[model samples]
Target: MPYQVLARKWRPQTLQDMVGQEPIRRILSNALEQHRIHHAYLFTGTRGVGKTTLARILAKCLNCETGITATPCGTCSTCQAIDAGKFLDLFEIDAASRTKVEDTRELLENVPYPPVQGRYKIYLIDEVHMLSNHSFNALLKTLEEPPQHVKFLLATTEPKRLPITILSRCLQFHLKPIPLELISDHLHYICKQEQVTADKTALNYLSKAANGSLRDAMSLLDQAIAYGQGSIKSDDIHAMLGTIAQQNLFPLMKALAAQDSNQVFHAIHLLAEHTPDFSNVLEELISLFHQIAVSQVITYQQKTDQQITELAALFKPEDVQLYYQIALLGRRDLAYTPSPQQGFEMTMLRMLALQPKQMVVQVETPTLTVAESPSWQEILPKLDLSGMAYALAANCTLEKIEDHKVILQLSANHQPMLNTKLKDRLRESLSNYFKQAMQLDIIITAAELYTPAKKQEQEQVERLTDATKAATQHPKIKQLIEMYDATIEVSLL
Candidate 1:
């Protein structure tokens, strides 16, 4: 016998043999058992997700000599013929080629006739959306009201092109893409059955490269087997798919998490030897960061990798969020740069540069005399406040500080940040700062005030304005602008 491809040889011969389409299988099986099969059925989904395969199994169930059943006896002549694609009653039409109205009309011409061998004359149209509008018009009448012994099974990757008139006459079921874990498990089973020595890592790479298509995964598996000389290895799969190995991804992530710039560059330098696709590298980082974030919130049944668990502990949740966002935006702009490696390096450096700097509030020593009191700005750094509590205190000015009570005035604009929990935290921090218990009162008003935060902002603006003025007055800048007929836009560091 000639060599048969794995996809066709392992094609599902029965509904029970199908994978990753539980709902469709259950519905079709119930329909067969209850004799509630629709005259016209439409299956919609992406390619290689078992739309036509399930349709063939349904045909076998309908025409088996034993009876109409969810489980057709494969030993029967009728079931065997349908499986072999030689059943006289089964008409497998490729709508892509025969899209003319005349072809459709000719096919429907026989719809009124009875079955020659099987119980029903089944018309299975693959890629039915390719049929012309006129062809659809010609077949609408027969499709809607076919004879009792005829069944129409239509499959298409794109269902939107089909007219609503035809769609309404058929029962449509949309198949979902197979999940990565399920695909990997299935591939592992297939390798075992074929007596092939395959590593788990190899199967994982194949499943991910398949992108939710079993047929594509099977075809890639066949190529991997031939390329590896009847073996499946992670290195061979990575070389075949132009994907970076998962182990290599961990070093990059670890360097980023540690904020070690030297290690990050070193990792990239080592990665250059493989000529890896930087875009895929960024994607892998994004995916790993996502997994780490999920691990922090939920406990998975399968234990996460030791490296991932360690790296997850090294960064804060907010830091992970910041890195993930920057990585995604970097990927979007990567193509515009001169080279992908340069873009990827810049992205990683940006993540480290913008790493959320932890706030370290340092209080100056009290240098004032007993009569000279400290201002709210001077007292803010003394208080052990952080996060929202620190923000609330920074935005407010002290109106009065008494023996047992204190009054703070918050600007009307910042009133939205004030809440009961934040107010309590502010009061606690103030009591600790003063080394005494205190009651607190807050009042909101639109009044001119010099909050510590406002003072800091004013100081920053003045410094920037001074720098820009100095740059604008530089003789070199003036000479360059005149010589090149160019404009100088002074930007402050």
Candidate 2:
């Protein structure tokens, strides 16, 4: 016997053996146990997510010699025949090749007849959405009122293309993409069973590359086993996939965070030697920035490397956001560039050049005159703060300034936004702005106090009022109003 690929060899024979679709599995199992089987069932999802496989399992459950069951006995001839794709009653049709109305009519002609060897004649149509409009119309009547002896199992990647009439008659189950961790774990289990040596990191790389498809992961695993000569390794997987190691991306991120032009180019030069897919490199960078941003804003629970945590602390949240957006655009525009490497290099350079420069505050403290004492609103813009730190500062009113301390009064409503990190950032910004080290002391107060945000809101309202008044007074506007009998929309103005 020829050796079968991992995907086929590991094909789930029972519903319980299927992985990563617990909700669908539970629903199908209950329906089977209750014997509340639908005449026509539609399974819709992306490729390799087990739409067709689930359909086959359902067929076996209905036709098994032991009788209809949620757990069909694999040894029974009916179950064995269905699993081997030799069952006479299970008509597995690839609708992509036979999409004409004639083909649909020909298939439905047998629907009225009783099963030759099984309990029910099952019609499993894969990629059913590929059927033409006329074909769907031709199948609509039969699909809506199929014989008691017939069952229709339809699977498609795109269900929206299916007519409402056809969709309405069938019980649709949307299979979700398998999660990465599930795929990784399944691959690890398979490797152990196959007696193949494999690294966890290699499986993880394959999992990510599979993009939620277990079949794709298994196929990639088969290729990886051959590529590594039976021992799966991370470096071999990366090379096979045209991607760089995760650690290789760290140096580039570090260089970007430091905003060192020479280091950035040097990192890129070293990365290019690996002949990686530049688009994938950009995607990795974007993912890293996103993780960093999440780490900065929240108590990120996802397991991250120590370097990522350090980089998260080293880079500001706003900078991470900016870099993420730039990397996104860079990836999109990569194809139009002269070369992938050039496009990637330009994207990295753009990130480095556009990063906000650190303000060089003089260390010496200067005495300020009474006239030179600036208001909080005046100082807010110059602080160059962003994210929650900016919001915290904007919502607080300056209470007083002591020798080494700055007191702020935060409205009780906005007190929830206050945190130790924001307070430290605010303090550092103030110290920089005043050219002296200062500590922040925030007091939550219910007393009404003017803040920069409120001041700015008032100023905007005044400007809008002035603009509306000016627009209403314009001669052209008066003529148009008189002719059209229209009132001025102050908000629009």
Candidate 3:
């Protein structure tokens, strides 16, 4: 037998063998078991997501010699014929090539006839959206009211181009892109069955490159196997796909975290030597920033790499967010640059230039006795807080400190900020500031209290009133006001 590619060799024969697409698989299985088959079915999704492949499986299920079943026996002649693409009843049409109204009419002419071989005459149209408007108009009537012996299976990557009349008449199933982990696992399983030596990291890289398409992943695996001479390695896969190793990105991230310009350029110089796809490098950096931000915000049960943990601890949450946005913009603008490496270098430089400089200050820790407890307003600025935690702290007034518990009264208006995460963060910040373990009790009160936020508001109002009064009394202002018949507006001031 001639050499068959991995994608063709591993083509799923039964519905159960199909990877991913659990929902659609389940639905089709139930429909088959119940014998509630529809006349026309439409499968829509991106390329290589098993749209046409699913249609073929459905055809087999309907035409199998063992009778209609979700689990078709691949050995039966009918199943074998369908699999071999020699089934008389299965009319596989590529709408891209035969898209004229005449071609459509000619095809629909056979719909009224009964099956010559299989139980039902199945029409599997691939790239059905490529059919012209006139062709779709010709297919509409026959599609809506096909014979009991006929089943229409239409698959398309672009379903929007399909007319609503055609879409409404058919039972549509949108197949989602296969997830990365699922694709990777499927590749691993295939490697085991094929007796091929492969690295797990290499499979992961291929899976990401596939972007949720199992067929594409399999094709890439075939190329990878050939490239590695029957074995797969991560470095070989990286070279094949023009992607860099995950470790290559860590050095740049570490440099950025440390704000070391020389080290940043050095890291970039080393990375450029690999001649990586800089756009992909930017994407990797963006992904790393996102991971770091997630790590900073939440505790993870999974064991993270020591480098990621260290980077997360070194960089602030806000800094991660800023870097993520900058990397995203950099990736988007990479194509317009003179060269990809220059674009990548500029993006790194931009991150350093725009990042807020951290100021180091040394202050002696003051011991506070219960009798000498500081005002809540004074403590608010000292606590390490940002985002919702800072907002929650600013709107709270210290009630009392009993033992290690710090009681706070929160304004009822800002009650929405009192989630467990924010509350725990506030408690942690307070504990850190006081140089001792502390517990927090926040009571929401509708009654107004002098919170730090309210105090600041009052001081701002007083200053504005003083400024307006001073402006109204000024000689130049009074003369201009009288000349223009204008009254002083504090808001304008």
Candidate 4:
């Protein structure tokens, strides 16, 4: 009669009711039907992915009054008692608390005794990894060879902590995290059954916020129901979860795709009122870019808004990849910045600034005279390059320039930067610099000539060497060694 949370209330009583774990359910079901019961079984997965729930369902199957069966007759007293958590033979231990070797020994002392009320004495230990090394040692012998009437169901989120000796004895069933769509559908079904009016999009946010855990999704759903006063909508869910509105992100994406600084700032200002977590905002932006990238390759029914489709069309595939990589790096470096907002703004600025430079579209070639020919190092800094194009140029040494073809040697290690798109951009930049359409041929040979990057490194090393020599010959250094016989640990300034 007491109030039960949706997670507990909707707990799968049989394997058939479980969602998004078909493989695990099928294996357990086959084991039950074939009576291929193992003395010890281990269920390993993250929290709320039905590790304990599956263990309970397996216990019911073992003790069901009709017989040991895959599909337990839920009407029977044994199943009913187990469901109510009052079954005598089913001992559910929270190993986190009872982790001492003595507790393990005491618990195993009863393993020899026959089941009091059921066919099998089920020892369901939750968080089995929390047991001490000595306790695991204590459990090893009995766990390997328990009594005929005994069964061990070990569940742990951190299975790696469990000793290999104990792990080897058990039939390990590693449950996977439920898929996003499945969790969303499950939440929608629960909302309908509970008479809770909810938008599909609202359920989607909850499902994603759950991060592939059904119990987590259900908990968030309960909070959302109360937050929305029983009617769940996307806007309210976003507000409740402190999540960036997906719609607000579209304008920023549009601005980024168009390389419009003003619109990017305006869009970010609109979100400023919400005081959004900029890291999460970047994450949402990254997600949108990822979706757009996926759309380029695989053709699927568009569940996205017209804005997303239009934005996807606006940006090329290479741009999406570049923006995604920049956003990820920005998010990674965000914590070290002065503030989250500044870090986020700089990231957006970077995307816009790099866009035009990285664009591979044809443009007017710059005028150049043969009399003004300069070294590759000087030529590199003079060229309008940034991002991968700039990086590719900096790492290359000019081999030869004849008529319309320019040959360069890049280090073999940096060959990953030698893609068709980068090559095309480099060729275009060279054509503009040379005032003629040029073909850039790159060879993956060691750069013997002074590259821009190599020249810069050489300059830095020379400056450091000069500074160290200057300091070593200083008057103060001579006085210190002569006066006190002090040996100084000198380093470059």
Per-candidate TM equals 0.71, 0.73, 0.73, 0.71
lDDT of 2 by residue, 235-345 (tens): 999889988887798888888888888999999999998889999888888888887887787784777667778889889887887788879889988999999999999
Clashes (N, CA, C under 3 Å) per candidate: 0, 0, 0, 0
What lDDT, from 0 to 1, does candidate 2 have?
A: 0.88
Model 1 stretches astray by more than 4 angstroms: 299-302, 357-493
Error of 3 at 95 (Å): 0.9
lDDT of 3 by residue, 1-493 (tens): 8999999998888888888899999999999999999999999999898888899999999999999999999999999999999999999999999989999999989888889998999999999999989999889988867889999999999999998999999999999999999999999999999999999999999999999988899999999989999999999998898899878888888898889999999999998888888998888888888888877877747777777778899898888877887788788889999999999999899889767443222222323222323588778888989988898898999999888899999888888888999999999998998889999999999988777777767666766676677777777667646643447665422
> Model 1 over residues 295-323: C-alpha lDDT tens digits?
77677566777777777887789888878
How does model 2 score by TM-score? 0.73
Error of 4 at 318 (Å): 2.3
Task: Find the 10 residues in a row with the least total lDDT in model 1.
Answer: 361-370
Candidate 1: residue 146 Cα off by (Å):
0.9
Off by over 4 Å in 3: 357-493
RMSD in angstroms between candidate 3 and the native structure over all alpha carbons: 17.2
RMSD of each: 13.1, 16.3, 17.2, 16.0
By descending lDDT, how would the candidates be arranged?
Answer: 2, 3, 1, 4
Error of 3 at 330 (Å): 0.6
